[model samples]
Target: MSLVPDILLTGAGAFILVSLVIVFRVVRGPTMQDRVIAVNAIGTNIVVVLALVAAATGNRAALDIAIVYALLNFLMSIAISKFTVERGGVL
Candidate 1:
């Protein structure tokens, strides 16, 4: 049992914990913005996990996916904001 694997596993566990918290917020928050924030946080955490897994496994494809995810997150956020404003602030 090396410390490296333990550290990696700990990182993953932390990701899971944060993801759970975000999910809870997304599900129970009274405001749409709160849910959006939680969703964005989840996307960020997913990108981080993708990068970590890529580094640990020496997989190049994971890095590409992470990059795509990052771009998609940004685009989605922008689109959502525009839609919200156009919809007169309703979700």
Candidate 2:
């Protein structure tokens, strides 16, 4: 109906597509660091998607959940890096 909704939906779709491509990179990465980076990129895309959904649906709760998810993603990345370092660069 409205152009704004169509635009947001398109953006969400694009984000999903990008995330899928990143997933492929994660699965086929030659190195652990590359996989970790791909995973992080996926997480970022997920956050953007969540925000888009929240805006499209006018749901404040979704925004809050997205914030929490983002924090968790950041912590996970840090933990992965620490683990890799402790394991002598082998993940």
Candidate 3:
């Protein structure tokens, strides 16, 4: 029963809670850009959670997945922005 694991779990839980709030914003966003930003934030939170889990479990694979996920999230944000611009602000 180490305190380190408990702290890591708490951190992950906090990240998840914040991500959930971001999800609500994404769902209820008044504009497309707002939703996009919220989605990006959620992705970031998820990445942090993955990193924490990797640290807690000493699993390198989780960190690798987090890296790949972060790349995909970045690409998706760019694509969404481009699409928004091309479509004249329609999501």
Per-model TM values vs. the true structure:
0.86, 0.92, 0.94
lDDT of 3 by residue, 1-91 (tens): 6789779979999999989878888889999999999999999999999999999988999999999999999999999999999999964
lDDT of each: 0.83, 0.91, 0.94
Off by over 4 Å in 1: 1-6
Clashes of each: 0, 0, 0
Residue-level error in angstroms, candidate 1, position 91:
12
What's the lDDT for candidate 3?
A: 0.94
* Regions of model 3 farther than 4 Å from truth: none
Candidate 2 residue lDDT tens string, 1-91 = 5678678878999999999988988999998899999999999999999899898888999899999999999999999999999989974
State the lDDT at 47 in candidate 1: 91
lDDT of 1 by residue, 24-74 (tens): 999998877777888888999889888877766668998899999999998
* Candidate closer to the true structure by TM-score (higher is better), 1 or 2: 2
Give the distance in Å from residue 65's predicted Cα in candidate 1 to where it truly belongs: 0.5
